[model samples]
Target: SRPPSEEGHSVDELCPNVRIHEGVNVSNIMEVPFVVSIQRRISPNLFAHFCGGALIRPHWVISAKHCFQQQRSIDSYRIVGGTIDSEDTKAESSEIADILYPDEQSGSHDIALLRLKSPLTIAQREDFQQLKLASDVAANKYHSCHCFAAGWGVDSLDSGQPMRYLKRARLSMKFPKKCYEEHLYHTGNFPLYEDPSLYHCFERGEGEDRGVTMEGDSGSPVYCHVTDGTGRVDAVLYGPVSFGYYPEDANGVTIMADKMTYTSNPQIHADWIRKNMKQ
Candidate 1:
């Protein structure tokens, strides 16, 4: 009975309200090697939506860019490379071979790249791990990385159900004019803080249980892990799950969600992935 924006959230801004109970699950974690999960069948009466990709080589694949600008091309997709259990994936087949978004409408340069027709059998290679794209990041501050988000969202959001197995979350890293001064100035809509290309931000729960990005994880891949002398994958590919900044409500308490969750900046497509990835 505390919903009026959780009584104006002051419990240190809030971010871990719990409330999962049970029903839809997806957290095998495999002990973090290299996460990848991008499912989209788009047929047989819909129902196959999940986004979250990264595996920078062995035929490339990096996502976001509104996860493919509403499809209509790229053969309508079907890629499900390694890990993130669709059933213990030893390679369950989803062999897509081409897809690239980002013509303009630059919401900080979304992001999308996928090419895999063949090349991916180094015998599984310990479940894949190949990401290295940080073009000397610098714009604002705050960097404490460790991002790995496998999708099939909804472990709790009141449980809409659809979390089969492939869920991992541990995010923290905020910058981008402090995410446009805390949640894009309550979303006045567009023009989020003078377009600082290659966007970045990741903070969790700060006003009635927050810390967002769910629902198939919208082209996920906001990574980290760079030990200076060649450690690899420091930044690139962001935004997916944009919504939050609940000032507050009232009555019989119906919070449902709070704020702080934004990603969408894959290095402004890095020149559209060097003019269409294939390297």
Candidate 2:
């Protein structure tokens, strides 16, 4: 049972429910109730929590397809929710029962869905609320708008290690060309960055609040608020965080300070998503 709230909650254009270990933490569990941690159960005593995801339905989740590239099987993965901190093991959890995605055409399609072993009674959980899948209209409406991403990625610009707390970062939709020019690892015409079906959401953190997604953030939801003409803003899921990079400028040198994040276009896969759900 997923209950979606208004587009932009007044307290914040919120991000994945996060708690920052350092700097200003912009997100919390209540703000982003749909966020979840996807983990891999390597053995009886060991586990590797690798990525972030959004709960779209009680039993359905949205995440980056590439997250499963090394996925062994349904039994090897798990989903944890109802908390902002991944280090906390007391959160509600479930085993991933199944996973599905489209064949890749050179990274054009990076979105995937997971089936939880059991339904998440979202209505019963105070800290867990599912996000509504944005319509094509909603997606277009929030274009370049203030969006947020939450996950357990790197803690600092220089750190590659995963943070213990969920982190929220501000971002906006970027055009394909701008994405290529500003966010790619290089200036060359990369097909994935040029693909219209994907959205390049960029975050160059300013001041004390640095907003960026890192290595472990793949499959995290990239979302925003969709305001109806009447000013009612409903939180909508835009896409799943796909990749992040620092692009080069005309000087042929990479800009280490600027971070570019890409998300799979949920609007582009709406039809397939609906059809796949019934199977």
Top TM-score prediction, candidate number: 2
TM-scores for all predictions: 0.31, 0.78
State in Å the error of residue 264, model 2: 0.9
Give lDDT tens digits, candidate 2, residues 125-224.
Answer: 7555446666645544442234678888877656776777777776655656676655444444455545655675666643344577778889998876
Screening candidate 2 with a backbone cut-off below 3 angstroms (N, C-alpha, C), the clashing residue pairs are: 6-233, 6-234, 6-235, 7-233, 7-234, 7-235, 16-150, 64-219
TM-score of 2: 0.78
Clashes of each: 12, 8
For model 2, the superposed segments whose C-alpha errors exceed 4 Å read 1-27, 103-107, 123-129, 136-145, 180-187, 205-210, 229-231, 248-254
Q: What lDDT would each prediction earn against the true structure?
A: 0.52, 0.70
Question: How does candidate 2 score on lDDT?
Answer: 0.70
Candidate 1, run of 10 with poorest lDDT: 15-24
lDDT, model 1: 0.52
